[model samples]
Target: MPKGKRKGKFEHRRTEEKIYSSDEDAGIDMTIDNCSETSGQSDLKSAHDDAENEQEKLEEKVLEMIDALSARSNAARAGAMVSLRNALQRRHLAAVLCNQRATLADHLAKALRRGRDGERRAAAGLAPLLALQIGEEGVEEFVNEIRPELAAAAADKSASLETRTEVMSQTFTYV
Candidate 1:
């Protein structure tokens, strides 16, 4: 990163130094050496770490929200859970998410079983994202796990129109 000139009292370099800690600095050396012209490594690492930490904090907050909020209140808990689960897309958490892929996938299906239309759509969407992290083949596993119940749910007019549509859409991809 360029170390010169700033418009303020604090040096721009010092401001940057504080953003990426030594751990991120050291971890990025290999990438920096190989691809020297890429965006500043420190800045990328800092952004990644900040994003991961924020997700973890948010997931913790969701767990708290889930426990504190009534389960019957689908909109509230579903919103929290959807955002919490979507963090699986990050590479840093890929292994952890992959390890929990079956559980996560299963719960996603169960959410369809128990969720409102919007929540069901959100949960069904998580399957493909989890499959990308786990493996393309896991899409079959996800489909096998969820299909029976969703088929039943789709038959039920009581099911959300959106949930029925999302479940139909998922069939084309995973099945």
Candidate 2:
């Protein structure tokens, strides 16, 4: 008897020996010749890359809107300011804006000092949120760089009392 056929009462489950010239001949599925790679992993990587690209485009658009705050048209500037406020509501977007704190502070300071009433109010509202997002270091930088303009705005007789009050409150909070 063959070695596989020698079993009696305790017969081996695989009593028949299989000879294979190829994997398919031995009843093996050869679809996945390489087990190291997975289709799901590639799909996940592609999705992640797409998300990153979309995020980058959004950041660029936000920066362009920030620059638009200096537009000559009051309507245009107001629209841009509104867009920026909405964008900054997202924490990651706020962090990205905060990373360029110097430029942001400069633009905001300019808005506070020279922009129309709506723009000034928008800048005042955004300052605290920006400070909060960037934490202590950002607050310090904002105070050091933009404080004078804020002080000037607070004292500007042309500005609405409500706007001035808001600026003063933010200044005290940062200090």
Best-performing candidate as measured by TM-score: 2
Can you tell me which runs of candidate 1 are displaced by over 4 Å?
1-73, 85-92, 136-140
- lDDT minimum window of 10 residues, candidate 1: 62-71
Across 35-132, the per-residue lDDT of candidate 1 in tens digits comes to 55455787799899998898787656544533532356667657755665555543334544544556666566667777778777776666566666
Clashes of each: 0, 0
Error of 2 at 153 (Å): 2.0
Say which candidate scores most in lDDT. 2
lDDT (10s digit) by residue, model 2, range 1-175? 7665575654544456565677677778778555446776887899999999999988898879877876887778767877877777764565576677887788788888888777787777777766666555576887677777777888888888888888788777656
User: Which residue runs does candidate 2 get wrong by more than 4 Å?
Assistant: 1-37, 94-99, 132-139
lDDT of each: 0.63, 0.76
* Every candidate's CA RMSD: 14.7, 10.2
lDDT of 2: 0.76
lDDT of 1 at 11: 63
